[model samples]
Structures are given as C-alpha cells and as structure tokens.
Target: MSTQVFYFVATLSILFSLMVIFAKNPIHSVLYLILTFFTFTVHYVLLNAQFLAVVNFIVYMGAIMVLFLFVLMLLNLNKDTEPSKSPLIKIVGVIAGGCLIVTLIGSLKAASISSPLILKNPGLGLVENLGKELFGPFLLPFELSSLLLLAAMVGAVLLSKRDEVEA
Candidate 1:
C-alpha cells in the first residue's frame, strides 16, 4: 500500500477511536466504535487481507455494534445519567492504554519477515472453499461458539433486569 493511503487510514482510525471514547452519548459512542471498526477493516484490506476485512465488518461493525446499540437502547441510558470519570482515573486509563499500544507496536516491529509465503496454487472459488472449511472442519466449533454467545446474551439480559429490579 502507498504511504499516503496508509496514513489516511491510520489518521481516520485514530480519529474514530477518539470519537468513540469522547462521544457524550452511549448510542453515539457505539456508532463511533462502528466507524472505527470500518476504518480497521479498510486497514486490513490495504494489507491484502480481504477475508479479515470482510470478517471485521461483519462481526464487529454489524453484529457486535448492533448488540451494543440494542443494549444501550433497552437500558434507556442517556448523557444525563452517564457517570463522569475523575481526572486521576482518566490519567491512569490513558497511561495503561498507551503502554498497551507501545507494547503492540514494538511486538509488530520485532516480528520476522519471511519470503515465499504463498506456495499454494491460486484458487478460484471463494464461497465453496469457505463453506467447506466452515462446515467440514469448523462446524462443531462454530455451533458451540454461537451457543456460547446466546448464553452470554441471555445472561446479560437477566443481569440487567435484576439491576432494574434492585434499583
């Protein structure tokens, strides 16, 4: 990828990430996170990882963000009720997040580059290959993961309902 395009994507990613954290409303925060996920998807595409880009869009932007919005709406939270963080806590959070970012960048920079990565013949059919892999090899894991997600959703609903009752 060209440096200009890379810088643009990185800038957009940073901007959206900031918006996600700084947005006053919960719904707006979720929307900003969706934009951030899309920017990340674009970054993945620029790196030639088309499958990852699409998956990022489908999983994060589509499914997870929808879930976030649904929960936010169901709870009826607004800016008025949102808790304000203390300056000390905000500073600690920023410091912790910056440390994580530095570690990730360092590890990525230290990763070794290997040549001749693609040794297989180019395949023509994507859907067929994806379906075969998902159903044949990954079927059980896929189903189990969905079941886990369902359980988590039900648990969240129950927990939130209990909180409402207590309040």
Candidate 2:
C-alpha cells in the first residue's frame, strides 16, 4: 500500500512538473510548481525522513510560495481589503472568555482552601540527603526524562526557526 501510494504521488509529481513547464500563464506555472513541491514533500514522508519532509514543506511550500506570490504581485496586501470579525465569532469569544474567568476563580478558591506545603521530614528536605535519594534510586528515570526533555526542547527550537527575509 505504501509503495502504491508512492507511485501514485510520483506520477502526480511528474504531471505537475509538466504543467509547470508548459502552462501559458506564469501564475498557473508557479501554482503547478508548488503542487510539484508538495508531492516532493510526500516523497520525503514516504522515505520516513520526517525532519526532511517538514523542512521541505515549510521551506518550499510556505516560504517559497509566498516569495513567488509576491514576485508575481498576485496577493492583495492592503489593510482596507481585510474583512471585519463576525458577530457570532464575537459571541463565541465572549463565552470562551467567561469560561476562562470562571475556571480561574474556581481554581483560586480551591487553592485557598487547600493546605500549604510543609516538609514533614527534616532529613529528606535537606539538599545533601535529597541528592543522595535522587541519585541512589531514581537516577535512571531522572536521567532518561531529562534527556527526553532536552530532545523536545531541541525539536521545538528547530521547528520555530525561520530563514531570514532580506530586503
């Protein structure tokens, strides 16, 4: 099934490439090229190169397409063209805001009713003893979780990164 999907996407990619080359209008050609790039992104996914697929989609489809649109002057950048927010959306926003306020008030009340933190054992609260206990029994899990957190932070950094737009 995977191989079949790959073949199908590959054929679509070739068709899009031909459309990009032979299209009469430049805008149509650029749109077809974007479709071709999208198929390439799918190919990256089929190859199990997740990072490469994400990078290709973000770079080629997102940034490069924006560049193409700007180059072709195909986008309307005027603020006057923007549509006003709908009344239903405004009502939904108000309801969501009210829900958040109620949640916050409930949480604050519950926290005030709760007992304050007080370490029952004096020895266990000490830095030296705490370190001993952590490194003694919980070392593996502690290290593994820290490593996992580090990996997540790195992935977040990579995802949020953007190429600089030069004037």
Question: What TM-score fits each model?
Answer: 0.57, 0.44
RMSD of 2: 24.0
RMSD of 1: 5.0
Model 2 lDDT tens row, 122-165:
45634566578779998999899999999999999978888567
Could you say which candidate leads in TM-score? 1
C-alpha lDDT score of every prediction, in listed order: 0.83, 0.83
Q: What is the alpha-carbon lDDT of model 1 when measured against the actual structure? A: 0.83
lDDT of 1 by residue, 44-140 (tens): 7776657767888999988989999999999999767778889999999999999999999999999888664562533312456656777898999
Instruction: Report the error of model 1 at residue 114, Å.
Output: 6.3
Where model 2 places Cα greater than 4 Å from the true spot, the runs are: 74-167
How big is the positional error of residue 159 in model 1, measured in Å on the Cα after superposition?
Answer: 4.7
